[model samples]
Target: MPTTARVVVLEGDFGVCAIQELELPDPGPHQAVLEIYAAGIEHGQLQQVEEPQPLPVIPGREGTARVLEVGSEVTRCKVDDVVLITPWSADPGREPELPLVEFDDGTETEVAPAGSWGTNLILDEQFVVPIPNLMDKEGASVLGNTTLFAASAVRTAGVGEGDSAAVFGCAGVGLSTIAAAAAAGAGTIIAVARDDERLEAATASGATETLNLSSAAAVERIAELVPGGVDHLFDCVYEFETASRPGRTPVRDGGSALVVGLPGTEERQDDLDA
Candidate 1:
């Protein structure tokens, strides 16, 4: 049976977001319907809303919910199971592209709309990961993407016990990386940012040292702390000049500099050249 769901839709015009009622389709053969309990709002979602996209699309990427119904082929979860809604499938073997929506004008466009802000959601079983019984929904919602990104960054950098790491950016992803690095037994976790509050948060998250990028001698100070640069440099902000400067580079020779954030088109071009 179809159900009406209140969804936050972003119109084609930039910066227009509103709630509207829409009929949600029933779960497909390999899908499940969920009652969303909590959804996370991140800076990436804010950037998405500001960019031009297909009209009247739902804008959300991470959430937590309880399974209300499942299709016949679904076996990973059952009704009433708490699950985290991940942007990609939990199963690494399968990679399914987002479904394309066709407009009344007969024009079709591939809009990767995640309708998690709605009261209910119907997603493929692959995208839902069963959550622990004691975990809070709000925390679980942000955990999926935030932790995954941090873990991926650590893995990419090959950070290991007694290794030194420098995280450039004290935002959600950067702070998460610090925590993960600490948990992995990193010898020194340095957090770099401009904001004092975020720097403090970074310290609490397990940063052994913090650098204020606004300071004129910040790069020199980092070099002074770790004479030969850090073993791993996680660039979460992707600032073109700062991240690519050879004189002020944060990574040691042959060390990995992992960029985990999206850069602007011009910056990307510059990065390619560098």
Candidate 2:
């Protein structure tokens, strides 16, 4: 018997479609079959489409799953272990960041052994991070990537006690940035967004000040709260006109603007003007 699964495929230029009947091989040594639960949509997928790669590709970067089957050599998981699938599975001896999975398929897929964007996926045991006992499925779906990005942004901004910081978005990643910033001991944390609900969430997460930009003068409002300007500006809503333009303006003369959002080429070029 063969296993068929449904997956999202990018056929060609700006083309994304759902198709079933994907052929998946059974677990081989060091591999496992995953039953995917939730996947996060990141900007990498969109960029890959616009830039163009080989044909007939899947387009998700991260997800959580349950181990459905394990290869003979796989000892990390059994038939029902819950795990978070990082896009790339690295060599076991090396840390998770340096993934070593390779394929002769000659496609520039983000994951070393490809990825988990479908109802079912075959993954190497090394790529699967066990979901913590406390973390729910949604939490596990984004923990690894979200944690890495937050840590990277915080380090890039040099956040520390007595430093003032501002985050220009309140999406999941943006909220993660806020929590990381607060935990890093940033004296004043400001969050700006058009969503009142998200702003409230950011405040609860760690933001000392929340500004609703839904009306106007959003930057001015942020500036009023920061006074001398923030020590670090973390812009996650870099495409929105109001949020994008405020990063440079909100930073003190020597302060730095760390862009965490993924912007397109044109928008990035516009950032040069800042």
Candidate 3:
């Protein structure tokens, strides 16, 4: 049976979006149907719709929902279980192979539209992670992707007990990196941002120190504080020429520099050499 679903659709590359009714298929043997509670409209989704791409696609990547129906073979979750819907899985290295959608016009698309801004969703059991019963639905929805990226960056940097780390950008990912570093037992955590207000928020989120990137002596100051430099440097902004260059120096010689943000088209070996 097909269920009536209300979904937000991206109509074109000019940022046009619309709400329309569609028929969602019932869950398969390894799938589950969920009543979506919250979905985050992230910047990446916005960029997707704004940039050139196939039109009439759904745009969203993270959300939370309550399971309403489970397929016969599904054992990971049951009815009424609140779960986080994310594009990511336990394995970060591999991409998910989602089933394709066949439109009524005989056109087929291979992308997974499960995260579409819809009232309900039919997703594979593997993409939905069960959350604690008491967890806030909205928070769990938005935290899934950003938290995974931040946590992975921290782990890749080898932050451990008594280690020190510095996070740049102070955006969602940067702030999360700071908190993750603190939780990982980093002895010192430095948050860097161009804005004063974001720096304050980073401090509240467990940053032992905050640096205003706008300051002319910001890099020098960071070097002075950490002496030889921190154990890890997380570049969340990825402004390689300006930010990552100076940012790299604050990392101890053997420490890793993790770039979390997207880089520009221009290639520069000098940036990586830092």
TM-score ranking, best first: 3, 1, 2
Error of 1 at 266 (Å): 2.9
Better of 1 and 3 by lDDT: 1
Candidate 1: minimum summed lDDT over ten consecutive residues — where? Answer: 96-105
Error of 1 at 260 (Å): 1.5
Off by over 4 Å in 2: 1-4, 26-31, 42-51, 69-79, 88-114, 124-126, 142-147, 214-217, 240-244, 252-254, 265-267
User: By TM-score, is 1 or 3 better?
Assistant: 3
Computed on alpha carbons, the lDDT of every model, listed in order, comes to 0.77, 0.71, 0.76
- Candidate 1 lDDT by residue in tens digits, 62-100: 889999988888888999999888776666686543434
User: Worst 10-residue stretch by lDDT in candidate 3?
Assistant: 96-105
Q: Write the per-residue lDDT of candidate 3 for residues 73-157, one digit (tens) a residue.
A: 7777999999888766654454544534544445565547456478977777777888987998887777766777788888888
- Backbone clashes for every candidate come to 0, 0, 0
TM-scores of the candidates in the order shown: 0.86, 0.74, 0.88
Give lDDT tens digits, candidate 2, residues 1-274. Answer: 2346676666667665555446566666787878888876666545655666666566666778888888888877788888877654446574332222222344434334335667877777877777664667866677556555776789888899978888888987789899998888988998888899999999999999888867577778767887888889887766666443664456788888877856645866577565
State residue 114's C-alpha deviation in candidate 1, in Å: 3.0
